[model samples]
Target: MNHNLFGIIVVFAAAAAWGMSGIFVTLIIDSSGCSSVALAFWRDFTTFCVLLLYTLVTAPHRLTIQKKDILWFLAMGCCLGGFHIFYNKSVMMNGAAVTTVQQAAMPAVVTIAAWYLWKEALTREKIVAMVIIFSGTVMASGLNLFTLERINVTGLMVGFIVPFFYAGWTLCGKNIVNRYGAVPCLAIAFGIAATMLLPLQPFVTQPGFLNCKIILIFSGLIGLSTVGAFTFYMIGLKYVQAGIASILVMSEILFAGVYAWFLLNERLSFVQTIGAIFVIIGVAWLSFKKPDAASE
Candidate 1:
């Protein structure tokens, strides 16, 4: 198989595995009723273990401090930690389907950021893809947040925080991919993130604040999906062309929807479903286009 094809296949398979996290999270949410803080706290702890082992294997030497990158590491840690915290909160507040849509919008967030910050060219293909994805998202979900009752409004807004942080991680990841190496960078990133969330650990001990089932869910999320999936993404991205690697990763949303439907018994409205399609198509276009092709 072509290296690019192989890499993309790997990244997406990683994505599919990640897609199931929602189902797992939802299972805990419904059965265990985990508080957002507690859920995030436990999740990070699990992530810490995964990253610790990974770094030991790939870049044990990176264990030594790089003082220059401390600030950068802090920022990356904050972005990543913040995303996980708020994403779990979104899951608690608005339900997973809506948050899933917000996550789907990450490519748009990253694309625009790359254009402005990295001086990446926005080629016709990219423009079209983003537009289509945005249109699909809007068509499926509709931009009007007011349409949903007052209750949904907050959830939707919080859900958006997920993408914002994801965009941060994307750029931050790009910066470190060449310098720190993906495994060590991620391991360190998760370590910093874990420290950031440690204060929230108190929430885990209080019975009212959390329960066993929720802890189990959080444990599961951290153990396999969170770190393991990222490990796969970094490893696979190395083998594949960046473009194709990204497109295949869209499988996450697809996986989320399927899992949500069966496990969570959740469904999106017609417009939302349409929006999902648009997001998928738009992101797919982005995958095939090169940096130059996108700029043109």
Candidate 2:
């Protein structure tokens, strides 16, 4: 396949993995009885350990960075940390479906950042695709306006903020990967984020069950999912514009809905099914090849 096609596939696969994240999270919590903050720490710590070994064995040279770049790594790490912290809190408060829908805002944030930071063109087509995707995500999330009583205020506030940190992480990640390569950048970022979160263990609640077998299995699952997702995302980011990439990622909502319906026995309404179709259409439209542009 061509570059664009490959990038689209990689990004969509990453989104699918992320869509399953909520399921794994629920499993780790329900089976292991771990708090969300603790899970966040374990997720990052597991990812950091696996990626570190992979980096060392596969490409140790990529790990080298100038002293000046340390701060950028730290900032990226903080961004990643903030995204996870707020996102887990949102998931706990608002439910995974609603929080994932709220993250649809990442596309808009990415578009604005791409325009201002990278001088990427803001074409009408891109804008329309973003809107379509956002609408589809909202629809796919099965959000009921009538059930306002079920909504948590803190969750809504934190959910709204997640996209900002997510956007920051993606934009900064694109830059870092361009310079230091994806694996090394991800390794360092995960390490720093895990370190930052480790201190919170004192303040956060611990897991009720401390089964070693369960913890190891959950850690492996989370580590594999995170590593694959981040690696694919970085690869796709290399070949695609940040804004369009972000829009394509809205497919996660559809995937998440499907997973919830199957795994959690959650109802998938007709409206949500229609929303999933719209999301697929929008992603395909955005990823479609432009004949004239291709010829140029």
Candidate 3:
């Protein structure tokens, strides 16, 4: 098989694995009665442990970072920790399909932030894409203007915030990722996030929280979705162009919708389905358009 083709396949597999994250969260919450925060903590802690071990054994040099980069790692950790907490909560509140579709606005958010912060030009294509993405996010979230009851206002709000947290990490890790490599940066960030959330863990208050089923669910979440997804996606990036990889990664949203529909019996209205299509189109458009500046 061609190397690029193999990379594409691995990336798609990673996206599919990531798509299953919401299902795992739902199952864990249902089976263990764990709060979103607890789940986020355990997920980060376990993923960190695994990645730390892998890096330590295979490439210990990757783990060495200058002390000056600590702040960047801290910012990444905060963003990552916040992302997991909000993402899990959004899944719990609004279900996976809605949350993932809403999250499709992340590229737009990051683009706008880059324009604002780093003077990256906001091209006509980007502006149009952002408009489409935001509109689609509203629709995908089932936010009907006329029908108040059909709208989950809180869930929509929570879901909307997800992209900002996502963008935060993306921006923060931009340079740091180059400095220390993706896996090590991620491992450190996850470790920091786990440390931050350790105090909030409910192990002391919630008895029998560590059951067989929950442990298995956590294993899948941490092993497959967190570690496996990131590792495979990084490897895929080596073989695939960034633009193509960005477009391909949108498969995560579709995979999430399919998983939610079949596994959780979640259904999208016709309008919501159209909204999801809009998101895909907008993000793909953005991916195809060249950046205004080469530096960007």
Best by lDDT: 2
What lDDT score goes with residue 229 in model 1? 80
- Model 3 lDDT, full chain set: 0.74
lDDT of 3 by residue, 1-296 (tens): 76667766777887888888888888888787777788788788888999898889888998877899988889888888999989988988887766876676676666666667656565687667667756765566576656656447798899888877877776666647667666887899899999989888755323134588777877888888999887676566555444344345656766777777897698988987887798678766765555445333
Clash count, predicted structure 3: 0
Which ranges of candidate 3 are over 4 A from the true structure?
Answer: 1-15, 117-119, 137-145, 150-157, 202-210, 232-251, 265-268, 290-296
lDDT at 179, model 3: 70
lDDT of 1 by residue, 1-296 (tens): 75555666678777877887776666765676556666555566567677778779877887675777677777877888888877878877776656766776776676676767766665577557756755565555344555665456678788888988877776676656557676777887878887888877765532232567656665667656787687787667566433334445655766766766787597877876877777677766665545363323
The TM-score measured for candidate 1 stands at 0.80
Superposed by TM-score, candidate 1 places the C-alpha of residue 96 at a distance from the truth, in angstroms, of: 1.1
lDDT of 2 by residue, 13-101 (tens): 88988888776766666676667778778778878898899989999988887787888788888888888878877877888878887
Question: What are the TM-scores, per candidate, against the unseen true structure?
Answer: 0.80, 0.92, 0.80
Cα error, candidate 2, residue 150 (Å): 0.8
Cα RMSD, each candidate: 3.8, 2.4, 3.9
